[model samples]
Target: MNFLPTDDQLAFRDTAVRFAREKLAGTYLQRARIHTLDRQLVREMGALGLIGPDLPEEFGGMGLDYTTAGLMTEAIAYGDFNISYIQLLASLMGGMVAQHAGRDISMEWIPRVIAGEKIIGLGLTEPRGGSDAAGLQLKAEKTANGWRLNGEKTSMSAADQADAAVIFARTEDSTTGSNGVSAFFVDLTEKGISRTHFDDIGTKPVGRGSVFFDDVVIPSECLMATEGRAFGTIMAGFDFSRALIGLECIAPAQASVDETWAYIQEREAFGAPLAQYQGVTFPLAEAETQLTMMRQLCYYTLNLRDSGNSHTAEAAMCKWYVPKTTCEIIHQCLILHGHYGYTTDLPFHQRYNDVLGLQIGDGTAQIQKLVIAREKVGRVALQYDKQAKGGAA
Candidate 1:
């Protein structure tokens, strides 16, 4: 019901914003040219308790709630888009490991992650299976010793920067349906693995790349949950990660709006403040309207998570709604800036590139719509509590 950030959250957000502007906004060019996320910044993020903020303190995390964590996402994003992107992705990936793995796994890895000592990224999308996670072509075959992974994941974020990755690969009888997926913890620096980063529109530091593991060894202990059940782990992960992606969308959208607002109040066009023009005002208003709607949906999905309720269809809806809306809002904000926005002189263009990635990351808008349609026309939305009671992750 409350649509506002708490006072402390707001203060934290302001601090993050100031830190971002002072630290990153002016320096990084939108070449999509950078190769790795700033480890120092990441260290600062860990020190601030932003990375895996919701995780337990004993694990070296602050264990903030989803609501507070979501607010922090918006705050970090307000300063620079790439930081927000990296921050949220790290949190979600770490959350998956912390949530599913045993105490031994948590004790060994969680503290390091919370200390900004390590980075975790997800690698599930393959060249052949962009939207179809269950159809992942990567193979992780069970062995007498442990398991062997062999395949390439494409267009993933943070491949090079991550100390480890949460990978979803085919393990069960491929003849079967979505039952074949199994998630694993693959060390990036392991033998028979090659990592490469691509030049992208934004979030250059996160290092979107391909991970090819050729007969790479994985210990049995590194397996998350059990075999043939990863489709549910992945599906539930989407429900959580997708909603978080919505917050990612919201952050850049807010940044674009804030920057545009600042420019309009000060910049004179035709001897009048730019905000005076209907052309400028109307688009801003329209963008705000869309962002408001998207933010509502984002919060709703987060609430579902907090309540331990199933809202898979809602996750799809927000995933589709927020990123697309965010992309649109960023461009509109840029258009208002005219020549200034188009240049790296202002952060508008950087935001434009940053927001571009969100539209496709996590899941494309097309995939989300299909999920929503499938839910409406066939089965009910995914149920977290009920499904868990039935032993469904």
Candidate 2:
């Protein structure tokens, strides 16, 4: 399949790149250290139609394809990796809402999200686990007017800062795993909702935290998809996000590599420029090759999604491989810069730390590999574990 950007896609990418380079790159380091993102900056991105340009024209988006969305993600990420989280969340969470939530809900929130007037965070991962997404413990009991939620979601980006969230809860008392799970659109300002932030090593601006829902209530219209089957339907959006995430991680590593390449030309070692050394140049060359491949893979996955094709395996591959490899590439770039890379004055350390989070967030390498295997061989790959545990295979 062709991965070349069309004129319109290229135009969007150029605009995103210009905004990133001009506005985001200059303050990336300063912004990275902060716990909360600057809302004004987020609004500026919204004003530029850079947040969720792929949602739909009716929802305040430009009706762009997922591939164009990936392009925008990559371009913005090149300037500020953390800031790109906004674009990622908007597309992932906003798309879910647009496709699943009631029209009124989508009409009200999607525009705000697109306008950067509000933020909607995902509430899938619980305090128990993130990778085992279906094993939810949050409770959502039907009330007279709506549902009452009582549970805690952990490791969510923008937990404390989100205006609202798409929360998942188990509605069936006798069921376990994904069966009883239901999704909800809950306002974070509702009563009994509390949040706590973590002192993460990176992506601090995204503010990974726990959102505790204590007897929180939401209207019946908040329920998304089938009551007991929302888990599977809502999760399909992740395949899209996974590919976008690949681009997100790749951008910073790419930026680091680009900087190191320029650096080697000026820095002298052994009375010669570092660029003249095969030892220094070879790793950068290898990095470029890998980056090119990973970028294509990510865009290919996005294209698969745009084409209405099954991409679970490819998305899993992108999710697992790209983040891990990009982290390594960033680390190597950091080392190639010597001690300066370790210092805060340079962006290498920050880029490493920022990209490092993706290796753990979304899903871990081991988990993604399992997903890939499951996709290739179906449930057969997991039958052995079920048999060992005395369950029906």
Candidate 3:
């Protein structure tokens, strides 16, 4: 894989940095205090073409490769930790709609999503358990007019703020686990729908919450692709999102590291700069080393995707490792700031809180490890219970 970025990728990264500086730098944390982003900020992101990097150009996207999308996400996270999620949702859910939804729906909504005119949330994780994604309980019953959806999707990003969402519901009762589930593009304003936002510790601008669907009606056209076949496609998109999330968390830690570097060079201890002490300098060096490794792994996963290769294991590795490592690095950076980093005056605390949330979202470290193990060992672990029972004397 190429270590150096292409001209187009560099240009996209530059644009992302400029956009973050102008639109997010000072205002993001202030807005997060209120627990939501301004609608106008999202529109501005759309105007700058930062919303959907990997989507086709015909659908108002840059049509760049997924690696370039990762670059944009990484760059933006430097300024605003929560706002990067807009691009994250755009890349994952927006791509799913573009590929699986009907032609008319895709033509109408994908451009709006790409342009940031509308926000869409992915509704997969329920209140029961997020890791066992295939074990969803939301039920969609067939009706005369169309389908009636009755369920609650909890911990959805942009839950209350999103104009619409791609919701998954159980459509069949066959022995198949995930195949019994199907995907739907539902308008959030429809009757019988109620929402409430969460008071999350971090990433508040994205508005995680629960969406209740009580006999919500969905037209047949809204069903994405075929019944009993949507989970595989949606999970594949998660493989892509997992890698992007790695950069999303790492970029902020990286920014903290940069800030700490500058601070140590200027601040003095024992009549010398803090940078002169090995205790101060070595930790930063180690943080930088970890950041560099995670960044390379993120790009490698994205490159695998760009080359049309199966990267589920690599993506899982990224999802599990990056956030955990970034959490440690940022913690070190916080301590390096001595007392100032613990306060709200600086962005360090906010970034730490934000990155901490990622360790639980998308797929948790345990879930990602499970996916990686399954890919490497072919589900033997999954059948360990059966094997253990058989081996019992």
Candidate 4:
């Protein structure tokens, strides 16, 4: 119940904050516009043990708790939202690989991911839909030596740049939905794989794109968890990522608020500083209040995960609410800055666009609400029962 950070947690958070302020803040805008993240900077982060410190030290991490990872993600995002994507993926996708993938695979690739020498992306959403994640279309047929994968995964973050990916494919031809899906760790540089990047409005450095697999073959050892039953097990890791994502979205919005506070104090309006006007100051004050509440909720959710408690409902709440609310806060901060915020010279527009993506990416607000309802009332609250009843009629 106690959310207070121990001394060790505070040390990790302080290190991340110092790194972000000194190394990431100054060139965040410059880096944000780029097509790919700075590999050198990522390696720098890796060297400092900032990537996935929660993973076991045997796998090249510091063996910290999930809350520490969340704090690092939030601190990094405050300086550069795009760079924090690396932290998110490392902890989310990399953890999946470590826990589910074969020990050999985890040892070989995870260390690289933790070291920032490689990136691991998730392959779940297809061209058809993301929310119906279980209804994947990618095919993975068993082969003599391994599995042959043939399909396209779209909307993958860092799709083109990721060194490897944990892909979910439909393994049984006759079965559908979550029943027949299997997960695999595939090297992106495999012979039959091709990649493309999207022209997104924000998070350009963390590019979103499509990864096309054409009869790509991976060894059987790459298969993660129980074959044809990996969907539910592998996906449980998202509860951790959802909470981290809340922190990720909050940081940039907070940065914008901080900048606006300083701006209003200096800019004069009606022969007085803008800060003198209650109209200007009130919005920022309200934003601070919202940010504090959202932050506490996010950390509390992370704590639940760390404590081995059920957090599906809380994680969904963090996933759905924080991103949408923070985007609003950032937009308000942009308006408070007047026309100056609209210009590219300032970070408000970029922060707004970046934070806005999260509202749609992880899971939409509507989907999260459905998850919450299902958690509260079981299957009776889901659409499957209605569909079944209509079919029976």
Candidate 5:
């Protein structure tokens, strides 16, 4: 029932906070203006062990827990809303590489990924749809040499910039549903691969776009986990990333609120500071309360993960609750800024744009709620399923 962060968590948080303020805060907007990120900054993050601190020591990580990982992500988000995705990707893909990829592949790539020398993107969502992740349409056929991939993955983060990707394709018939999908660690630069970048509204640094694989040959050893069983195994770690995504959105929203509070306290209206008025102050108070609640839930979900407990419902709660609340809170902060927030002159607008994307990505609010419902109701949640029709009364 301890609420305080341990000494190691505090040290990591302090370092991440300092790194964000010093390196990311000042340049975040300027970089976003051009929809580009300095690759060197990622390397700097790797140098500081900020990329994947929760990864094992053998993989060039600090071997911390998921809760500590969330703290680093939250602190980094305070300075740069979009760059925290780098940390998120590091944790997600790096964990997969360490645990699922072959030994030679892990030895060659894991350390480099930890050092920020390479970037790995998740290629699960296709151009057809994203919500039904297991029902992917990408085709992977067995070849004499290995697997031949022929499909396009759209809305992928780091699509054009990623050195590699953990791609999922259907090795079996679509009738197999989730069980038909197989994961592959493919080199993005391999022959027959083509990519195009998207003009996304936010999180510009990690460009989202489509990656087309046209009969690309992948070695057999590149297969991750058991073929056709990879979807559930690889996706087991998604709960961890969902919680981190929650913190990423919350951190920026919290920052905007803090900045707005300072503004209202100093700015005057009708010969009195804005903070003196209940209309202005009360909403801020409400926002603070909600932020505190969401923050506690996020870390608690991570703690559940670190303790090896079932947190599917809690992670879904964090993913849905945090971003939805963040959008509302940041919108208020924007309004509180009184037209200054409307302009690009301040970071509030940018944060708003950045957070809106989260509400859609990493499973939407509706999808998360469905997950929560499924977890809570158990078999009752599946009573209306098409497959359950035969057994239902």
Candidate 6:
């Protein structure tokens, strides 16, 4: 049965699908090889109001809803996951600033990001600490002028091109955990702020890099969410963004499936079509069924998310299930393609590499399990729930 898409959602999906197929079409391998963010495509997406569909209209966005955001993100991911990552993050970061920080920052930065004139990265991961993001070692100190950020953030996506960034750093009075962390908005072009790109297996178009903050003095306008309150913003991002990660897992798996399905129908063996072989049919059946489950779970999580409830457990379930399933499906599709899947010519090789990041980013599967386990058995949050919502702090 068809799982989602109200009439309006269907229309939204149609618009996104057309954009994906037409504008975002390119060889995934080529995109990665160049490691260049498609500035033109990003601007076109902004012009189409795809960047911040849920952000406030006054802030230069459509301000739709979670469902619409998910629909659009998934559609674009179906074409290019790198594009999905940029648009999803730019819009979400802007909205977060609106919600937790203020309207002024959103009003100014949101439009620039939406227009693809700027990029932003969440600087949580550090050289010393990763999953223990609260245990971050990067230090930020107060100054007469503003703040001085002195530390390094690793595995930062889009850092090289980012006009601005949210750099999480350790504070002097910080307690043992996330409390000790504060967020700073650092301009990449500002003095003492430097970044170097890192080559990786997938998502090469991501401008992923190491950003060193060498006493980078950020002005007051650059401050994103407040210092002590910054950790809250980062944690809050995951609950929603994890659901988006589920969509990320699906895109390449879906692409591989479609590609393999066509190939199987066209290629023949044993004097008959490979489609007639149970060997071919069973794997396809398994991949489709597994992907169906991932899709359903993601849809449910998105619905729960829209209801103002904590879907962290469900998001965890999806973040765990979808990537594993997507990886398996992609591998199976690759096998079904024989050697073509292994070739850079087909793009499956690149897709196979790209799917690995979803499992690692947005809190690893192991970390996600810890989150759910803490929430479920103890009826508690990993961090203290200040709002009494029984959710993440």
Task: Give stretches of model 3 more than 4 Å off.
Answer: 387-393
lDDT of 6 by residue, 72-110 (tens): 888888888788887678656776666665466666787
Q: List where candidate 2 sits over 4 angstroms from the true fold.
A: none
Question: Model 3: per-residue lDDT, tens digit, 157-183?
Answer: 899999899999999966346887899
lDDT of each: 0.76, 0.93, 0.88, 0.92, 0.88, 0.77
Could you estimate the TM-score for every candidate?
0.90, 0.99, 0.97, 0.98, 0.97, 0.92
Candidate 1 lDDT by residue in tens digits, 295-389 = 78877777777778878898998788887778788888888888867886676667677777777887888888878887787644345444767
Go through the candidates in order and give the C-alpha RMSD of each one to the true structure: 4.9, 0.8, 1.9, 1.3, 1.6, 4.1
Count of residue pairs whose backbone atoms collide, per candidate: 1, 0, 0, 0, 0, 1
Evaluation by TM-score, superior candidate among 1 and 4: 4
Model 3 lDDT-worst window of ten? 384-393
For candidate 5, give the lDDT of residue 310.
92
For lDDT, candidate 1 versus 5, the one ahead is 5
Highest lDDT model number = 2
lDDT of 2 by residue, 1-393 (tens): 999999999999999999999999988999999999999999999999999989989988888999999999999999999999999999999999999999999999999999988999999998776789889998999999999999899999999999999999999999988899999998899999999999999999998999998999889999999999999999989999999999999999999899999999999988999999999999999999999999999999989999999999999999999989999999998899889888999998888889888889999999999999999888885899899999978
**What's the TM for model 3?**
0.97
Better of 4 and 5 by TM-score: 4
Tell me the lDDT of candidate 3. Answer: 0.88
Q: Per-residue CA lDDT of candidate 4, range 1-393, in tens?
A: 988889999888898899999999889999989999999999999998899989888888888899999999999999999999999999998899989988998899989988999999999999997888898999999999999999999999999999999999999999977999999999999999999999999999998999999999889998999999999999999899999999999999899899899999999988999999999999999999999999999999999989999999999999999999999999998888778788999988888888888888978999889889989988764567668778421
Candidate 5, residues 1-393, lDDT tens digits: the string is 455799989999999999999999987788776665677888998899889888878867878999999999999999998889889899989998889989888878878888978988899988667788777889899988789999999889888899999999999975556887899999999999999988888888787889999989999999999988899899988899999999999998889989999999899999999999999999999999999989899898998898899999999999888888898999999999988889998887788888888888778889889999989887565666855777542
Deviation from native of the Cα of residue 370 in model 5, angstroms: 1.1
* Candidate 5 residue-wise lDDT at 274: 95
